[model samples]
Target chain A: MKRSICISALISTLVLIGLGTAAAEVVMIAHPSVPVDIVEAGMIRQIYMGQTTPWNDELAIAPVVIKAGPVRNEFLKTYIKKSSAQFSTFWKKAVFSGTGTPPAEQNTESKLIAYVAATPGAIGFIDHDTAAEGVKVLSIE
Target chain B: MTSAHKSTFMAVLAALLLGLAPQIGAQDIAIHGAMSQSFMQTSDNNYLVESEDGSFSIFEMVLNTTANIDAKTRIGAQIYGREFGHLGNNHMLVDWAFGDYRWRNWMGFRAGRIKFSLGLYNTTRDIDMVRNSILMPQSVYTEDFRNVSNAFHGFEIYGSVPVDRLGSFEYHASLGSAEVDEAYFLHDVFIKVLAAGGQIPPSLGFEANLDWAYSGSLYWNTPWEGLKIGGSFVTSDLYAEESFATPTATLDMSLDMDLKKLYVLSAEYMRDRWTFAAEFQRLFVDIVVPDVPVFVPDVGVVLMDIPADDRRGGYYGQATYRASDLLELGIYLSVFHPDWSQRKVGTAETEQKDTALTARFDLTDSWLMKVEYHIIDGTGDLPERLNPDPSQLVKSWSMIAVKSTFYF
Candidate 1:
């Protein structure tokens, strides 16, 4: 019984470590030209959902995203309060109804970071460890 | 335009968009389409169309493309084709094409044929996959005047206002005119005339002259997440001409009607995978006829005037629960009355109640199948021509529908 308890404790520790690593993989980013250094979660949601069209400086805001996955799912759940499927359905409704358009989607983290850095008024999310030189990391308030 | 010309036009449009696709950034262009075919079975009383017997006649297809010209400017259009028993008749048409410009978060403008933005579901009613049920609640968004109310050719100004900690407010206002066909417009108008002791020959021909329409809506997003309330109003004018051959003479009749006003109040709450929504609507209609010579078969030509007025309204409440990643369940209760004031003649004041249950299964990311069953009471809104005499309709009936949709 004692050996079993010890093994269980060891397993729980390793599982928590794995979860911690996964949780640390994502962060919000914006083009270097963006003037804001920090953003509220609600503002982020509004921007990504196309509810907030222009930034404070009168420039149109462009939001980019990735295909569905664990990281993308986590980003949506934390910021937009929706699942990937629900998000897609929301945009589908908007597109078909001529109400609005969805954000652009990039294939890879490097490409997404590069696109955000190069495009004016662009914002996106990337892996925390990715090399992002010309982009600004937005601190969530 | 002829079918050949329409096809060529669509082809050329597609080619132009494709050829310019590379010049436009790949990420700025989006092309999507949806197709749905349904089989409907009704016990009796063809509701929206000819479905006396089991019918597999409902089909809808749409192809849409949107391109961002720049951060603040974008252009988009949708080509739609549908055959709903007798409504669309399998004709391909341009649904809407528009260019949008946003100066700031507080203001934007769109010019072209724009979709009519009304209640919560009016805008998205045509997209089957986004809706939980095969058929939307007809109580508020009646299928009878679908074409006339679908969209308008004009311009609109819309914007959103943030309310500090209380959330945001969205508003849309527009003025435009809608294209109408005489046959369908006459079908809807003659229902009341027939009820008013008028007879129309079987081979009736008509022409509709279009007029102006004005519409607007305002919505409030509450501080509490997933809660929203909104209201919308619309008004338009209708005019048409009908001519028929009699034994001794031909009668040309003129019709001028006023869709005096329409309003709807809506509320919705969504949490997790569950959604609850409700809407109440009111519609006022009137017919205006000036001095016109009428030729009756037995009587000589006489100047006659006949005008009618009625108030119609309805309400519905629905809830949906996503049971799993691949399945969803929904239920709705709707009730409608032809005349809210109950001033119209014989049985025209009858009310209809419908309770429906629906289920949708996502077969894949882009494919889905849905089934629904409805228990309906009364025959209030069915076109008079379809049922002829209201007394002949049974008091109760049921309908079942199954549809599959694919989107990309």
Candidate 2:
């Protein structure tokens, strides 16, 4: 009985570790010229929702997103509190209502990172493990 | 393909693509569209169309283009072709075109054919793929009045205000006028129900006109992530001119109306993969029509005029669940009271209740199919002109609707 219990415990630990690794850690990123280092969790929703005016009243906030991936889904579920389907539906409504446009899309995380680094007013999210040398990592409140 | 469908489809595609397609790769421009063809069948009389024999006369095609010009300015427009039975008649028109400028998070301005925020779903009614159900709730978004209730040519001011931890407030105020065609649904009620029933004189000519329309709404988004409660109010002026010839001379009479006291209370909650929503609406109309002498055939006597004005409105509650990545299911309980004053309650026509069930399947990334069934009780929202036979206008009926859409 003791041997069996120990084996089961080991298996549980391995499974837990695997799940921990499966959930990617995503970070909010922005262009270095954005002039902001930290983003309040509340404001990120508005920025992504296209509700707020341009940041600093000059630099328009351009949101870039990855096409379809776990990182994008995780970020949406965690930050925006919406599923992929809900997010797309929200954008579709905004577009048809003539109120707002959807975010620019990139096919890969690397491409999204590059777009954010190159655009002065761009903001995006990517996996924490990716190299973000030219952009500013925005810490969430 | 029918020329009507083919020409409309090609025209919308051509117009939208010519304007926004070449820049499809641009980061600041966004282009999206959807086209849906629906087949509807009813057990007895027609509903929204001649659905008695499984009619396929319903079509909604739309293309929208939006471009952001810096952070403070953006402009967007939509072109739509909607055919609802014998109306709309395959006309391609700009649904809405507006230039928006936001100076702050708490203030913004919009002009040029702005859409009225009638309720949770009016502005997005023509965009079919955004919702799980094939048709929105008829209580607040009756398709018969969409032409007049859709949008106006004017400007609006809107804003969002955050109140610390209590959540936020979103408000809108708009003023404009609408185009009233002779084919507006109100005329049908005048010519068919009132005149045919001998309440009004047979008219030689009829004219309908609308005046300035105004609307406002305030929403309080609770501290909860996906819960919101709000209300909207809209009012406007309308007039009708009737011309008739007696033995002596031709007389022209007018009726003054105010589409006033239109109110809608709304609530929506989104939790995980489930969505719950409800809305209640009331339309209070005040009319002033002079008593004119007219010969009546039904009563066989000359009598004074009596306007057919009664309070109208409805309420609906819906729940939708995303069962999986590929499928979703939804249910709706919708109720509408065409005559709120109990004037027509004896004929089993006081209210209409619709219990609808829908299932949606995502066939591909850009294609989807939906099937819906409705068990309706009452004839409150039925069009009288379409079903002339009183015996066939059954109190209890059912309908089936199936549609497919493609979007990007």
Candidate 3:
């Protein structure tokens, strides 16, 4: 009976950690001026890679990224299908070749929101619950 | 005039310009420098005797400036220096000097010294942060050949055409006169005179190049993905001629030449962390010697030297894996071969095959380091001058270079 009680206690602790991680929400965001239908994962990949210059359907896709950090890694894996390091190297090569440039990086969540709000075609991400006015939430597949 | 005196005159002129120029529109100036030291141990000392001991320094400095000339145009300049072992005292005349007139998105022209947009790599050769590999692919840009020319003075017309769904097509066409300084001519005097009169000769060789690239994602289900394929080709005319008169006889000679028709084929695939690329290049040079007599002193006989034609081709394949934001690993192999049958005396030809392996790591956003080792196997039948001593064949060399770049 004591062993069963100890096992239950460990399981509850693990569940709490999982719940805390899930509670930290990430939201795809764009400038209010941009009329994007839904910022999907594939679209974000295209804009960041410079494959798509201007968005169609009355919108322009501008992407902003956070500098490499724990939050950046979690967001990229969940939305971009790649890690932060891979994206960096890919963009470095592109920039060196004069073929493309990576999306601008913001140092903090507030900075990201400010940049996206001011830039007409800019897009970025932040904690879903913290998203303020002048930014639209994009859908992630 | 002595080189020192010429350099002094240039320095004085630069000082005068900076002192007297109007300050109303003066732009900011910036200075940058890099110092690197590396050591290596090799089995043989034949390739670079000084390098065999394995310690060297490669240092460089760049003076850059920008002036806001007007709303539509901006002026910029860069002066660079390098010191690499005994091959010290290297300089760059100008990275680029051009005026852009953007009348509209569909039409634009730039005139002055400009970078050759022949391939994806040529335009950004100077920016360290943007390149995919530590060193440029040799097949297209022969950085090893000390005098390999990368930029030309000329005019270019470029524009983009928008498409409905497939994305737009961007195009560039340029025409420019090739420039070769006195130093470059002196280096090639023994074999050929590639320039005349401190500038390109009056014949003023011309170059024309074209590039077509498409940008857009490839999948219908995922329309926002990005993929691009670009290719470029350039051709130029090179000419040199001279005549001599002697008491015993009169010798007249002329060479109407079309050489170094360079073509590059490149494709890049980038999705998330993996990037793959391949490049193939072909270069051809035609040499025509008109009735040049070769005299045999012992037999009192004269024989006309026959002209020859030579061709060279090279290819490279590269792959890179990004472990994280701070570290990247890359491996590439390249092969270069020349048609030995077409070689002539006093010419630039590779009698043997050359293969190289290179690895690069990015320690940080501002620092990059790379190491490359080369194996050169000389063909026994190389031209006499190229291999003055046949024993100098089959050599190997290893070089490690590190660069730290910063931008503000």
Candidate 4:
């Protein structure tokens, strides 16, 4: 019985480790030309939802997104308060209705960083460990 | 266009789209498209067409592009094709083209052929993947009037205001006019419905000309996590020129139809995997037919004056649940009153109630399939083309629809 218990414990530990590796830390980033270095959670949600179109009365809000993955899921839950499918449907409605368009999507961390840094008023997220330059890190409150 | 021509055109366009797919690789320019084909069947009467026999006649496709012409300006347009039974007839047309300018978060302007902001779902009524049902509620979104209600050629001012404690407030105000074809108004709506027990002679028709129109909406995002409330209003004036021939007389007439008011109150609450929504809509239409002289067999000249006033309204409550990542379920109860304060049109008041159940399956990230069933208790909202004789309309009926959509 003791041997069986030890084996069970080991399997549980392995499963937990796998899950831990799956989770990712997401960091919001923006172009250096953007006026703000921090954004409220609500503000992030609004900008992504196409509800808020401009920032600081000068900078037009342009949001970028990942096509899919855990980082996208984390960003959606934390800032947009939606699931990936829900976010997709929301943007689909907006786009088809002539109200708004979905944000640009990047397939790789490097491309995401490059787009956010190069385009003024652009915002996006990447894995926290991804090395990024020429972009401002936004603190989400 | 003929079905053969439309088919060839669609094939060519689809080939062109395949060629253009690889070029949409930039942030400043985007291309999107969606296509859906649906099959529908109704019991007893034809709704939209002779659907009682079950038809695969509904098709829709849209290709749209948006280009950011700077930081503050964007220009976009959509080319749409649809075959809604006898309505669209596989015609391809410009759905909307607009230039948008944003000054700030609180102010923006859009000018061109702009979609009218109606109820919560009016703007996206034709988009299949966005909604859970095959057909949107028909009372408020009368399929026959889409030509007048869908979009207009003009401008709009829109903006959203952020509140401290409350969530936010958004508003859209627009002024425009629409050009409607005689077939849209005369052949589809008036001729079918107003001819009583018989069909209108082929020689009788009317041309609908809109003078002006205005519409607006106000929306509030409440403090509650996922709750929203809003209201909308629309009004327009239409001038119609009519020509008719009877067995013994020919008549020419000019009429005025004033869409006095159309307003809707909407609310929605969403949490977790569940969404609840409700909306109430009311509409008023006044028609004035000036006295026209017509020759009669017995009387040399007779003056015919026909006037009509319509009071219509509807309400619907719906609930939807995301059963899983790949599946969704929805149920709704919709009620309509064609003329609430009337006493004499038929044996009973014209009221329609529909209870609908729907299921949607996400086949893939870019594809979806949906099926819906409706149990209807009245025919007040039934189109005349489907039921040539109102007296033959059954009080109880059922309908089933299935659709598949692909998008990118």
Candidate 4 CAPRI-style tier: acceptable
| Regions of model 2 farther than 4 Å from truth | A1-22, B1-27, B182-184, B192-194, B197-208, B240-255, B287-293, B296-305, B343-347
Q: Flag the better candidate by lDDT, 2 or 4.
A: 2
Tens digit per residue, CA lDDT, model 1, B1-408: 633354446446754764575587633677899999999888988877667788888999998888777667777778778888776776767677777887677789998778788789887788898878998998888876666677777899999899899989999999998555424535656545544545645535655544788999999998888799999988988777776565557757677878888889999988867889999998887876545556678897677777756578889999997766567789999988878766243353278888999998888879999999999987887876667766778768899999999999
Question: What's the i-RMS for candidate 3 in angstroms?
Answer: 9.2
Which is the better candidate, 1 or 4, if ranked by DockQ?
4
- Give candidate 4's error at residue B318 in angstroms: 1.5
DockQ of every candidate? 0.23, 0.33, 0.14, 0.24
**Ranked candidates, highest DockQ first:** 2, 4, 1, 3
User: Per-residue CA lDDT of candidate 2, range A1-141, in tens?
Assistant: 999999898656643532332456889999998978899877888888877777787678888888877897788888888877788888878888988777888999889989999998899999989888788999989
Report the number of the highest-lDDT candidate: 2
| Cα RMSD (angstroms) for every candidate in the order listed | 7.0, 7.5, 10.4, 7.2
Best by TM-score: 2
Best candidate according to DockQ: 2
Worst 10 residues of 4 chain B by lDDT: B185-194
Worst 10 residues of 2 chain B by lDDT: B1-10
TM-score of chain A of each: 0.79, 0.82, 0.73, 0.81
- If chain B of candidate 1 is superposed on the true chain B, what is its TM-score? 0.89
Worst 10 residues of 1 chain B by lDDT: B341-350
Candidate 4 docks with a DockQ of 0.24
